[model samples]
Each structure stands twice: as C-alpha cells, then as structure tokens.
Target: MSLLVCAYVFVPETNTTVAINEQPKAPFNNLFGFESWRQTVWDSPILRKHNCTLLNSLSSQDIYAGDAVLLQLQNELEVIKEHIDQITDELNLHKESFAFRIDNAFEAIRIAQKVTNGIVYIG
Candidate 1:
C-alpha cells in the first residue's frame, strides 16, 4: 500500500477546551497543498519555522478561519511553489513518481492560500 500524509489547518488553543471525542474542523489535507510521502519531513523543525513565519505574517493576532490571513498565506506559499517548480523541471527525465508528488504539493499550496487558520499537520 502507498503511504499518504495529510495536512490540516486549525485554530491554536491555549487550553484543552475541546473534548477528546470532538473532531476539529480543520481544513482538508489538500487545503494545505501537502503531498503524500512515506517519511516525516512535514513535522521537522525547519518546516515548522516556515509555518510559524507565515502565521506571524498574518494580520490577525489570533489564529482562526476568517481574519484575513489568507492573503499572507498565499504569499508565503508562492515561495514554496517556486521551489517545487524548479525541482519538477529538473526531474523532467523521470516524471513518473516524484513528479506526481510535486504536482500534489502544488495543488495543496494552492488550496492552502484560501485558508484562514493556523496550520496543523497530520501525517
């Protein structure tokens, strides 16, 4: 079976007000433009730093789904999209497996641009 990693965007809470049984309404995995992979690169500190930078750039002081953070996120995603494009172009000789992942990553970032919540990744 193939491994699938999903990404989610949600509100960051200071306390555990939510019940354990409740499921968060975070954005769909595809919303963040994340791609499926076998490893755990998404949880890395470097990536988290990038995510933090994006969030810090948002207008709203709190993380939520409608505070006008979308624009900022979109702008941040552009940088990642450019890098992915470059890698995809370089791998033109083998556009079968990794290429598809690159495509998925692009799609995820595109969707993430419209999101308003802070990013919460689940793999």
Candidate 2:
C-alpha cells in the first residue's frame, strides 16, 4: 500500500490539487526538499521516459485515443521532455553560479573584516 502510494506520486504534476493528507509537520518543508525531489527526477533517463509516457497517457482528455492522437501525444511529450531537461540544466547552472557568487562575497567580507578589525567590532 505504501509502495502503491509512492509510485502514484513519484511523478506527480500539479494538474489537480486533491488533498493528499494532513500531516502535522516534518523536518523537510522547503526548497531543499524540492531540490532533492527534482534531482531524483532529473537524474534518471528511464524515470524521465516513464514519466513522459505516463503523463501523456494518464490524462483523460482528448489527448488519449487512437493512432493519430497517440502520435500527437508522443510528439507533445517529446517537446515537454525537452523543456524539462532544459530547465533542469539551467537550474543546475544557476545553482552553481549562485554558490560561486556567495563564496566570493563571503571571502570579500572576511577580508574587509580583517582589515577593519582594529577599528571596528562586529559584536
């Protein structure tokens, strides 16, 4: 039952907002959790392909049907996969850039603090 629930939500897109449950609280409740989740998704080509096919087929809309519809769904799925991959790459690049900038900024602050230590007190 737990495995079934996990499998169902392992690639949940925000198409609908059915209340999952009401848990009191948890340690991971922020961007870090989302980042890890995203990494899990972006790390696996097989998983991505699985999600792509599942998402395209699972919807009950006009996209689900005969050969022509299936082809169009496949095409649209390919486009969505490309976009997801591109976004993941861009997010990784930005994360790296932000870390670099923050590191540099901290280094600058440290140097400045050293230079002003005789005349200034931080605390």
What lDDT score belongs to each candidate, Candidate 1 first? 0.37, 0.30
RMSD for all candidates, in order, please: 9.3, 21.8
- What would the C-alpha RMSD of candidate 2 be, to one decimal place? 21.8
The global Cα lDDT (0 to 1) of model 2 is: 0.30
How high is the lDDT of residue 60 in model 1?
A: 27
**Which candidate comes out best when scored by TM-score?**
1
Clashing pairs in 1: 32-108, 33-108, 33-109
lDDT of 2 by residue, 1-123 (tens): 000011011113653323223221232111111233333432345434545543322222211122343344345445544464454464544544333322332232233223211110010
Task: Rate residue 89 of model 1 by lDDT.
Answer: 52
Index of the highest-lDDT prediction: 1
Alpha-carbon deviation at 112 in model 1, angstroms: 1.9
In candidate 2, where is summed lDDT lowest over 10 consecutive residues? 1-10
- List ranges where model 2 is wrong by over 4 Å: 1-63, 86-123
- Per-prediction TM-score to the true structure, in the order listed: 0.34, 0.22
Q: Residues 1-123, candidate 1, lDDT per residue (tens digit)? A: 333322234536762222122232333222322233222233334334456354332222323322354444445445445554443454332334444543443344444444544332212
- For candidate 1, the per-residue lDDT at 18 reads 24
